[model samples]
Target: MKQISFKNKFGYMMGDVANGLTFGMSAGFLLAFYTDALGITAAAAGTLFLIARLWDAINDPMMGVLTDKMFRKRALKHKNQKVDKFKIYLLKGSWPVIVAAILMFFAPDGLNGTQKLIWAYATYIVWGMTYTFVNIPYGSLAAVMTQDPVERSSLAVARGIGGLIGNILPRLIVPLVLVQFTDELSKGYLIAMILFGVIGLVSYIISYYTVEENIVHQVSDVESTDKDGFVKSIGVLVKNRPFVAVSIASIAMLLGMMVNSAMAVYYFKDNLNALQLMSITGLTGLLPMLILAPIMSKVVKKFGVKRTVATSSLISSIIYGALFLLPSNAILYISVSFMAAIFMTIPHMLVWGMVSDCIDYNQYLCGKRQEGVIYGCYSFVRKMGQAFAGFFAGVGLSLIGYVPNAIQTSQVLWGIKFLTIGLPAFGMFIAFIAYQFIWNLTPEKQKEVVKSINM
Candidate 1:
């Protein structure tokens, strides 16, 4: 097997960069495009998000099991049994995902409201499916890349960095560019996604070439021989305290993050009266991530993922709570936002490593290698978080009486502030509680798990 190198690290980074370009864009800006650009009602847009993500959540596991089945079959067929299995799907699925991204943003002219809603549903479902097709495999690729806890931690950091870069680029560019096309909002998003798609696909291609699964371990056909494999594997994972805790906290984190992202533009535009601040926040918020991402492994090693994440979650909640209390003080808000963003970085860089550790725990308890299954289940929870965030944002906007392309009412602005700032704090608090009470996967414990897996 090949040794992991800078090339592999970069290739893996590119994979998330690719994902951030498309997935991140949708997460951050797509709701605005639906509510503001297309004049779709906030309630409808939220419902669409809920249904689509729920469907995608189901697909996440099915795809996970299906991929593992493919691997077992291929492994049995080959004498060499050394082929890189997981990274192979990066190129295969990215093109369709990229294409679906563009289409989801683009609806043909002269479509009535129901037709537009139908178009949104069809396009989004396909987009979500295509995303699942690529993401399950891509996410699973990291575990096989190396068995070293430090190296896996590094990979997670790389992914966080890449996702930040990918997400940030579009986050900065799309707002600054799209706001100018107020009259052509739909066209603006379509064109932005078109540009993002090419970049995302190219990034995936780079990743496919460079990222290698150096740890040549396999899940034997033992799983296949059992009639109740998927169920039994899932039950083990559910019972895994660390995995379950991580999943719960991850759900809260994703929910709050999505709400913050989806609502940032409105907060900036309506509350701050500075749409450009969106781009500015993206740049400033990225500082800690970029600076701290390289050293995240050391940080995780020093504090342990649970402590860092749990502590960061508490600190972040305070920051967000403070932001909510500050009203419309732009300077104080921005400064505090930067601090929260910095704390938020700790979890992004460490969570995957935690998930990796949980996978190890699964291997320890279940005595089977079911990385894809666990990761997929983890992803399913995160997606549900995203779904709820989407629904929450949409419904919150409606309740606030948010109107399209016009000055927002005072109540609407207050609601935006509440959704943007208050909810995130609550989410972080949940993370802190999860870490403190539920998850017990310490760094030392992880080392022991790895050692046991190897032996």
Candidate 2:
């Protein structure tokens, strides 16, 4: 077996960091940008999200088919070849996704109504499609790199460390820039988003060049059995127990995080009257990710993935719930919440790699390798979860007597409090339940599965 090096691991980690930059910023800021910055009503934003996501579900499977076909064609052309097919296709085709990511964040001025919605729909949907294009293959690259469980665990830690920097640093600093750059929040957010979009494009390109795929699994070159094979792919994935569990868990986690992101912005600006504290509080939340991520391999080895996630989720839930009952001092809230975030960051840093582990387990059980379908389904669930966050947050704000661009009311402040604190705590509880009871893949079982897959 070839030894895993810092160069190879860091290269793969770069792609993950780029992934975090694109998706994390989108999730963190898009709804706020739409409502507060782009002059869209919260209800309309929710409706837009519901409609666009309903339409966008088609993109995920289409991407899976597209990636699979590309892989198949590469194999055919390079038949009996020593070179890895996925790596070549990745190097050649990753640019479209990067371009699409940049375009998605480019919201020009001097547009109204239909034009604005059109821009949002076209850019956002295309970005989602492009994200699927890169992610399916990028995720598959993990298993391709190495079969050793220890090394894969190490890789997971390294990738998380890189991701912590990519994800946490921007979010922590962007708010400070926005607070300083423009008197209007929207204009500030717009500039910050564009900057992030450009950064995302650059990082994605760098990652594409730096990373290489090392292993290729051989599928039987039989005649195509069904023209409608994508449906079959979905069916195969549904039957995968580990896939289903991890998918549910990921959905819950993403939904909670998105709601928190939107609410955190609201809470800082509206409730606390400490908008600039957003930058400080964001830094506090991110601290654990930066410091603890490199050591995640040892943590997971000692505690195991399930215990690690479950413990973190539970601790976060309790703290989030208690935040509702605590005194609303900015310093006090920030202090306690940061400690909670330290524990909470573990799952954020490490869970996708756990999903990768689940994919390996599924392959071991089913006697088939379907990373594209499994990962595609996983992304579909995550996007759906994001959609729910947008929808719920809009409705939650509406119920809380929140009227945009209006003066403060005690009731409206209460509503913001509920959404920011109560909703996410509930979501964390749901995640805890899913992972603690639903996920049965322990480290020992994962080792057994890896052994079987290699055998």
Candidate 3:
């Protein structure tokens, strides 16, 4: 097995930290920002999310194809020089995303309702596209960095830890900081988002400088020029059973994680009577992931990724479902949620390495590598879940007659409870079904594919 240094591993972790800071910001808080700060309707905000994500679904595959073509051109031009296909995007794309991330939250301070909506549309869509520009390459980077399964699992753990830090740190600090700036909430969001954006930019640069792409898979000249190459390649991926199953699982997994996140403000504010409590709850909930992330590779070695994810999903489903029955006491809410988060974290920590395995399975089947395409396709499916979650959070709120700053009725409170807790239970249960039945890339099968590719 090839060895990767701690520095290289840390740099790899930073890439996902970059991803989580921007994405977690939007996923966890953007909908609330829209309705509360800008006076956008819950239905309108949900529609905005759905429409933007549908556009992203179109963008991911296109970016995948473009990335592969660009890498080949650069490699051919610098035949004698070292040319890293993925890092080039990371190096150049960081600033555009930083700018986009800040602008996405800015919303221009004062605009009529329609104009604010338009600004939201333009900025968020641009941010999503720019995010894809970096995210696809970052996701693809791991497959090239190491061909060893053990090393890839370690990389996945590093990424999960970084993402949790990026995600959790904001939750801990943002609510507390926002408390101090409550008189002007919009200004608070803009200031908070700007800080996260700059942090994201620095992490991206660290990742760009630190990672070495040790394995380069070259595209043959004929394959590059084939008129139908992209389409044909996608067809191959569709036929790759493990890839298809995993992609389906991605959709379900994101759906659960996101719905829970998107509805968190409602749960904290309406159900529990203090939005500030989110910071403490988030810190407690994340403790298990903090404990589990460092030793996750060993956990994977003992139990295997597929089995681990499936079991975690099952346990998390039960715990979150039970949360739907707990009394509204904050102590009980925090404690049960803390236990549930332990299981909620395992699948996330291991899912990316499982994705890298799908890449190996692709090469084994076709004798061709398309890491960018595969990762992008997987991301595209995952975005469907995101799209639906955004739509669901909005529509679900509307259906329950949620008023942004008013005391919710018991009926509305129940809806908030279901949206935050019960929906995730449903989402987790579906994920359990997907991985337990749909995913077939057992460790034994993965070993066969890796051996076949090496041979």
Candidate 4:
């Protein structure tokens, strides 16, 4: 076994931070932009978002297959030095993520309503599909980079720290940074999106150069997966009990996150009577992950990943439920908001690392390296959950008599309140249940799986 240097780990963490910044912006504010800034009705915007992302459920596995083939073909052509091929693929893959980030924010020249939705469909599909191309390979790079569990855990923490930076950038800074650009909301968001794309591109470039793959320690199983065989891989991966459980848990966790993301935007705008509170709430939501990340590994080690995630999620659910049950005061809101933030973030940081472990488990089970496909499966489900959240939020808003171009009624305000706080609270509760019962992988078991694979 070889060890990864601190320098390499730091570089990868910075890359993760940049990725977090870009993707975080989408989760943080994409729905707000669609409904309010871009002049699409909330329901229509929600449908479009769902449809566009559903396209990714189809596209992600293909990207995974393509990634596997790229590795296979490179192994053949390079023969002796196959590691360079994987590195080259990863370096080149970064650009698609950068481009997609820019395109998702683009509102074409002279488009309204139906036209805008069509434009959104086209660009958003490309963005989601291309992002998969980048992220699948990027996710797989970790297992290839180092075999040391301690090193991998450190990398996960650094990635969390980076994500905190990324989440903060668009949430906290964009509103302030884009103020000087234009009064038109769409234009401001467009500018912010472009700026984020550029920043992502620069940071991804640094990551490509600074982080090195631990090619020498890599286990070779040069079997190529068929791009047309997603259905088969789905069956195979689902049969792996741990992967199935983790996927379900991820869907529940992400549903909570995405739903709250949309609802929080609405809450701050309407009930709170503080439209700009998004920036403050967003900053507060982000800090816990940053502050707690350094110790997250130790915490998980002590408590174990499943228990830590389950507990945090349960706490978050209670806090979300209490947000409505408690008095609606400034101090109460602030306190619950911070607690909700911590709960939302801690589980997220740990779960992805856990998901990565599941990929390794699948490899051990099948005697094939299918990290890309497995990660794609996880991403596919999570994105589908996000789509569902968007749909639910839209439907909930419409049912609540959310009217466009008019003053909202007390009933509508009440609807908005439930959609934001109540819905996510339920999701968190469901997630807690899933984690407690479904996820059965303990740390010692995971170590055994890894050991069995290497042997």
- Clash totals for all models, in order? 0, 0, 0, 2
Error of 3 at 46 (Å): 0.0
Task: Please give the lDDT score at residue 72 for candidate 2.
Answer: 66
| CA-RMSD of model 2 | 2.7
List model 3 lDDT by residue over 75-138, tens digit each.
7787766678787787788888888888887857569999999988898899999999999898
Give lDDT tens digits, candidate 2, residues 1-455: 78677787877777766776766666667777776666667777777766766556556656656666666666667777754634554455456766665666566789997787788778777777676767767766776677665577777766776666666655687678767754576666656656666665566667667766666656342114124377776776766666676677666776777777777777887888887787776577657766786677788878888898888888888988898888666787788778767767777666667667767876776565655656666777777787788777876776776776567698888888877777767777777887788788788888888889878
Model 1 agreement with the true structure over 1-455: per-residue lDDT tens digits: 45679999999999999988888788888889888776689999999999999999999988888887777767767746686668888988989999999998996889899988998899989999999999889998888887777788888888888889888887789887887887788888988899989999899999999988876654453344234478888889878999889888988988888898899889988889888777887787679788887688887778877787888889998888888888686677778888988887788777887787887888888677677788889889888998899999988898889987789888888999999888888898898899889998777787788888778
Q: Which candidate achieves the best lDDT against the true structure?
A: 1
- Model 4: per-residue lDDT, tens digit, 1-455? 65777777777766776677667778767777776666777788778767877888777766667777766676766666635424454467677877777777766677767888787677777877766776766766676776555566766776666767776778776656445553576777778877777777777777778777764423246553544366777777876766776677667767766777667656666676655556776568667976887788788778887888788889988898888777545456767878887886776776657666777777777766576777777777777887788777776777787865367888898887777777778877787887788777787987888888788
In model 2, which regions exceed 4 Å deviation?
83-109, 181-187, 219-228
Task: Give the C-alpha lDDT of model 4.
Answer: 0.71
Error of 2 at 186 (Å): 4.8
Q: What is the TM-score of each candidate against the true structure?
A: 0.97, 0.90, 0.96, 0.91
| lDDT score of residue 419 within candidate 3 | 85
Q: What clash pairs does model 3 have?
A: none
Determine which window of 10 residues in candidate 2 has minimal summed lDDT.
219-228
- Give the local distance difference test score of model 1: 0.84
Q: Which lDDT value does model 4 have at 80? A: 68
